[model samples]
Each structure stands twice: as C-alpha cells, then as structure tokens.
Target: MATDQELELIHDPAYVNAVRLAGKGKLPKEKAGNFGIGTEDTPIFPGMHEASALLVGGTLQAVDYVMTGKSQHALNLGGGLHHGFRGKASGFCIYNDSSVAIKYLQEKYHARVLYVDTDAHHGDGVQWSFYDDPEVCTLSIHETGRYLFPGTGNINERGQGKGYGYSFNIPVDAFTEDDSWLESYTTAFTEIVEFFKPDVILTQNGADSHYFDPLTHLSATMRIYREIPRLAHKLAHQYCEGRWVAVGGGGYDIWRVVPRAWSMLWMEMSSNPTPTGPLSPEWLDTWQPDSPVTLPQSWDDPEGIYEPIPRRPEITEKNTLTVEKLLYPIRSNQSSSVKPT
Candidate 1:
C-alpha cells in the first residue's frame, strides 16, 4: 500500500485526513458528507483508506517497473480510479490512482506522460488534475456524458493555458459499435502520440464499453478489447520505447467481459498469442458456477451480439463529427506549418 505522504502527491492533505477518519468510522456522517463519503457512489466502508491506497500503490509499482527498465510494460488491474478528485471522491472511486501515478512519474523521473483513458466514462479527475500542466497530456474516449454521469468530456473541453491543446476528449455517441469506436481511437491515438511524443504512456483500459456492461450504453463487442491492446502495445514501442503502464477502470461485468478483456490485454502485453475459439475449459469450470450470467466459450463475442441499433448511421455520423472536431486543432496546426508544443 502507498504511504499517506505519497497520496499527498495528488490529493490534498485535508482531504486525505478526512478520508482516513471516515474509513475508521471516526468521522461523523455530516462531516463525511462534506468529503463526498457515505454516498451511493463512494460509501464509507471500513478500511477504505487502506483499500484505496493499495490501488494507488499498485499503479505506482507499475510505474516503477516501467520507468526503471525492469519491465517494458506493466498492467495494474486495480488502478485507474479516474473520477476521484483531489478533495472529493466521485463515481465510486475513493482515490485517483492514475493521477497520483502520473504525478509520481513527473516528480521522480521527470518524464512527459501521456494518459489514455478508454473507459466508457470520462476520466474527469485525472484530466482536471493535469489540465493546466503541459508535461502531462490526457486523452479520453468514452460515451458522451450528456446521458451519462459526471456530464463532462466534450470535444471542445481542451486543456487550459500552457496545457492548451493537450487534453483530448472524443466522446462518441451512445450505442456506438466496434468499427467506429476503433476508428476514432486508433486515429486520435496515433496523431496524439506523434504530437506529444511522450516519454511514457499510461493507459486506462476500462472494459465497460461492451454491450453486456450494465453501466455503459456502447454496443462494442470483444473485438475492440483485443484490438485496443494491440494498438497500445504497438504505439508504446514506437513512441515511448515500450514504456507503457496500463490500469483497469470501470468494468462492471466482472465475470464475463472484464476477465476476457483484461486477459486479452495481458496476452498482448506479454507477447502471447491471442486466444481464439473456446476459452480454457478448466478456467470456465471454476468460474462458471459462480457467474450470474452464462460465460462465452469463445475468445471473441459471437456475431450479432446485440440486436441491431436503429440509429447506427446517425450515431456513426455524430461520432465522426466529434472526432473531426477533436482533431481540428492538431490538423489546423499541421496545415499551417505550425509545430505543436
């Protein structure tokens, strides 16, 4: 677990104290409410501080492994609590591990960090944490928050001041399918990496965008998950010399989708072959009995996983517009022969 001092790298001291008190059930309900604890999203549970700190520590460990050349890439499935704020917890995240890890990277290694969040929700806290800092660039692609929680991540919500044009958000429409999602993701990621040339790439690989995920509205299948890691691994090697740290976020379907998506990520990172056809029967035999829903036998979701969306064309057009707008600033600079900072 991370030390309290380490958490202060991103979170406020006062907020840390409040969280500690609430975790031990010492803080009164009224007082905890001020810190955004005990609500439906961020409940005041025992050992909250320790649990949250452990999550942060896992990301820190990944950062250390990659930065120290002990590993080319590291994946922390417990990290990527991106909605946690400096002084407030939101969206069920008590601490923002990704923010703390990025700050740690900056302070310890003096590296330029590129944070890519692919969760179905906007990585609001991490974006805001480094919103005004040029050293850290955060790119998030998620379903539009107009009908989602946190209500942010608009295409025009670029960074401010010196950090302007660094924070990139591509909020696709609801019910967006695999092809459109990957198109936006691959295009933006390729362009941004070339523009920033970050020393290290930190990816928030949230699997909640799948159609089976209860928390999100996207219709993406397992194809995106397999392809997501492939691109990230390739780009990390190309731009950052293989320095990549991945963290998990907002995958609500822990049984079926999260396991498969996260396994594909690890497989890609470790240079193992992507499993196809049926999953290991041994693994299925162990987890299937406990799973509330039937687990898929194949590596990828079956064809026609969901009933066809009625507004597929409209959603695709709108998402394409958002991507174009998001890339306009970069494209404009290139066209005018102006270099990005």
Candidate 2:
C-alpha cells in the first residue's frame, strides 16, 4: 500500500532506487553513501532492504487489519523505526515503517490518524515528514531532545503550513522516575484524545526509556512501561472506536528488557486481562546462553532502587504540568480543529 508513497516520503530518488535494488536481491556493498544505509547505527547489512521490507510489511499488516475492521487494534512489537527519514536510514532504521503505515492509512482507510510517540528520543523524522499537514496529529512525549540523540523536539517546533499547532512535542525534564513518566503520558495523551479525535491511533512505544534499558538515561520502570501499551489499548477503545496500531521503537536491552516489555504490549493487543503469568519455560529456554538473564516469570519490575508506585507530589506535578502545557495551545484556539484526513 505504501510502496509508492514511501518513495515520495523518502525524497531522494537514489534511496528509492536502492530500496528497489535491495528488494530485488541487489544491494550495493560499497555503502549507501548519503542514503544512511552505511552509518554506524544502520550499517549496510546484506539484506538491509529485505529486513526493512519485513518491518514495513509488519506495520502495513497492522494498517490492513485495522482498516478492514478485521482487528480493532494491532501492535507490532518489532517495528517503528522513527529516526529514519525518507532517504536516510539513521538509527538502525532502513525505512520509516511508521511513516509508510501512516501514508497507507491515510490513502486506503481515509482515516484521520493520530500518531503518539513515547520513545525517549524525539520522533523527529515522523514529525518532520508530516509537519505541514494538519490531518495527522503527531504527538511525542520524550526526554528533552536537548539531552538526547538527534535532539530536536522543542515545544516550539509545533507544526507549519496547515499543520501549525497539530504537532505536539512534550519533551519532559530529565532524570525522571516512574511517577514522572506515567504522569507525563496520561496528562498529554488525554487532551490529545479530546482534540485530535482521530479515526485511528498509531503509537511508537519504545522500551528503551525503561530504567533497565542501556540506551537511554530516563528512569521509567517496567510498571510504567507496561502501562503505556495498556493505555494505548484503552485510548483506541475510548476515542478511535478501538482502531489502534502500536509498534516497537528503540530498545537495545534485548535480553533483560525488550522481550518482557514487548510481551506486555502483545498481550495488550490481544486484550489479555492479566498478563501476569510466568514467562514460558519454552521461550526462556531459547534465551539461555545468548541471554544470560533468565526471562522473569512475572513481567513486573520496580523502577527505582527503592520507591515503587508512589503517591508523591513530584510525580503528580510532572503529570499535571505535561497535560497543562499541551492544553495551553489548544485552549487558546478552541475552535481550531486539525485538518480532516
């Protein structure tokens, strides 16, 4: 569905040619000089195009299932390579799977989609790609890009052209704990649900923000990480009539964190009431020598060294402030609606 639109989003014809070349079992080994396929993060692997096609295909599957009403919600815990641009494959991303899916949703389903990103890194590529079209409301809640990689999610980077205020970037204070993290999500997302009024919701839920993740510095815990997927499911039912798609973003702690956290997300997509059961010994056995840490029977892991889910004021403040700031603009222009998809 998105192959043609993806070529446009990935502006460079050369990169598009490369994608085609890779698809046909002909990838250049010298490197995709400026195409972002040869960088340290996204090295020029042999089947780079094929692997990317799989990711894009996974996201497209979610789009197809949701648009056709076969599934009210879909979550692909292996997609969401947000940093990749139309041409460049930065950050281990060959193709912008989320963008391709969004383009497909807009074209095929004719649905107004709201993309909610909760990864620690700013979703700069996705936001920039649709920075001018108000039909897609791209909202991101991340640690200030100032302190992070590809840093650029400032609050003022709202939208341009028809999309002026539709793009919302909620970069939070650094070194936050579970309370701060949970509050931030609930706060900003609630108002977004009210205003965007999307026909469907697509989310990039990166697990790297977890305290156990090695790539990021934010201190969100497993309890909070687990809640994000749950909340995405809830939001789908609440506003978008249960049309939702959630994809995995950046998470490097493959053994200790990614598997457990993503399991919670898959369970959410399947509407599992209690995903508290022990990890399958069968699954755990597969991880033995490569992953030294045995998969936890239970997915729950506390965030702080001591403090768990606290009813403290600092956390409350974080959540409240995030919601309030996001609403500040919407309130000023109550009549302004996101351009219809």
Candidate 3:
C-alpha cells in the first residue's frame, strides 16, 4: 500500500492526516469539511484512507512494471481517482491516484508523461495538478461542463506559462452518439500524441460515457471502449515504445457498462481476441438475479438501443469544431515550421 509520504506527493500533508483521522472517526466533525470530507459525495467511512492509499499503491505498481520493462502495459481498475485534489476530495474520489502516479513517474523514473483521460466527468484534479508544468501533458475528453459537474475543461483552458499548449480538453455536447464521440476522441488523441511525444502514456478509462451510465449524458457504446484501447495500444507502441499504464475512472453502471467496457480495454492491452456474440450464460446467470436492470447478452450494444438523436448532426458538427479549435495552435506550429529544404 502507498505510504503517507507517497500520497503527500500530490496531496497536502495536513489533508492526508485529516483523512486518516476521519477514517478512524477521530477527526472533529467541524474540521472534516475543511478537508472535503463528510459530504454527500465523499462520506467518511472506516478504512477510507487505507482504501484510497491502496488504490494509489496499485497505480504506482503499474507504473513500476511498465517503466521498468517488467511489462509493457498494466491496468489498475481501482486507481483512477482523478477528481481528488491536493487538499480536497470531490466526486467520490480520494487521494488522486493518477496524480500521485504521474508525479511518481516524473520523480522516480525521470520520464516525460502523457496523461489521457476519457471519463464522462472532467479530470479536474489531475489537470490542475500539472497545469503549470510542461513535462506532464494532460488531455481530457468528456461531456461539456456546461451541463456537468466541476464545470471546467473548456477548449481554451490550455496550460499556463511554460505549460502553454500542454493541456487539452475536448468537452463534447450531450446526446453525442458513437460516431461523433469516437471522431472527437480519435482526432484529439492522435494529434496530441504527435505534438507531445513522451516516454510514457497513462490512460484514465472512466467508462461513464456509455448510454447506460446514469451519471452522464453522452451516448457512446461498447464500440468506443473497444477502439479506445486499440488506439492507445497502437500509439504506445508507435511513440512511447510500448510503455503504457491504464487506470479506472468513473463508470456508474457497474453491472453492465463498466465490466464490458473495461474488459475490452484489458483484451486490447493483452492482445487477446475481442470477444463477440453472446456473453457467457453462466456469468450472466450468476449476476442477473442481483442486477436491477437486465444485463446485456452480447458484447456489443444492439442496434437502436436508444431513440435516434434528433440533433446528432448539430452535436457532431459542434464537437468537430471544438477539436479543430483545440488543435489549431499545434497544427499551426507544425505547418509553419515545414519549409522547402
């Protein structure tokens, strides 16, 4: 498990102590709010610190395995608590595992890092942590904060000072279907990697953009999940020499959406054949009784799973423009630098 010092790499020391005390029911009630505890989103509970620290430890271990060449890629499904900040917790995330892991990558391995976040919610904590540092580049694609929580991640919130052009956000509109969602993701990720080639790539796979997830309004499907990892895997090999570390982020539909989405990630990372057709009857039978919603029987979502989006064309066009604007600087620089020899 991660020690107190490791968490302090990205969290305030006092806040770490507060989480420890609150986990034991020893922190004063009035002071808990100061550290973002005892709220509807992140309630105090027994072993909260231990639980959060363990997730950080898992991501750290994944980083070690990939950076040290023990493995080319690793996944920590419990480790993408991207909303946790230095002194405060939000959105049910504590300890900010991805932030700690990125800091660890820089300090321990001396590697340039590229952080890619695809959660429905903004990866606010991770983005803010390295907002001023150029060595760590963060790219987040999520639903537009105009209608979502932690309403930041606008197209213009690039980095500051030397970190300018290092931070990228593509906040797609609501009701965006699979084609439009993938278009934005593929375009931004492709260009960003070309712009900022790094020694390692860290991906936060939130899986909450799926239509089944109740927390967000994006209309993606299993298709994006399968393709997300495929591209990440290909890019890791192409640019980072196969060093990639993946961690879980926000996915509220635990029974249906998350499992299938994350399974595709693992399959792509490990080079396993993508599973198609029906899901195992034995597996479905085991969990179907407990699930309030009927579990999907196939790997891919069926046709017409939801009503056709009436404004799909508009949403797609808007997202396309957003991606173009976000990448204009990089594209401009690239084009301007190319001169006839």
Candidate whose TM-score is highest: 3
Candidate 3 C-alpha RMSD relative to the actual structure: 0.7
- Give the per-residue lDDT of model 2 (tens digit) for 1-341: 34544545544667867866755657665646667665677766555666777778788998889889998988777788899787777777777888878877888778888999988899988998899988999998888776688788887888998999899987776666776777778867887878789999999988888766777777676777678878888888999889999899988888877877787788778887646656677877777767755555556763234444444566457656766776788875665554455
Candidate 1 residue runs with Cα over 4 Å from true position: 338-341
TM-score of each: 0.98, 0.87, 0.99
Clashing pairs in 2: 10-86
The CA lDDT of each predicted structure is: 0.93, 0.78, 0.94
lDDT of candidate 2 vs native? 0.78
lDDT of 2 at 327: 72
Tell me the tens digit of each residue's lDDT in model 3 across 197-275. 9999999999999998999998999999999999999999999999999999999999989999999999999989878
Please give the RMSD to the true structure for each candidate, in Å.
Answer: 1.8, 4.3, 0.7
How good is model 3 by TM-score? Answer: 0.99
Clashes of 1: 0
lDDT of 1 by residue, 29-128 (tens): 8888888889998899988999999999999999999999999999999998999999999999988999999999999999999999999999999999
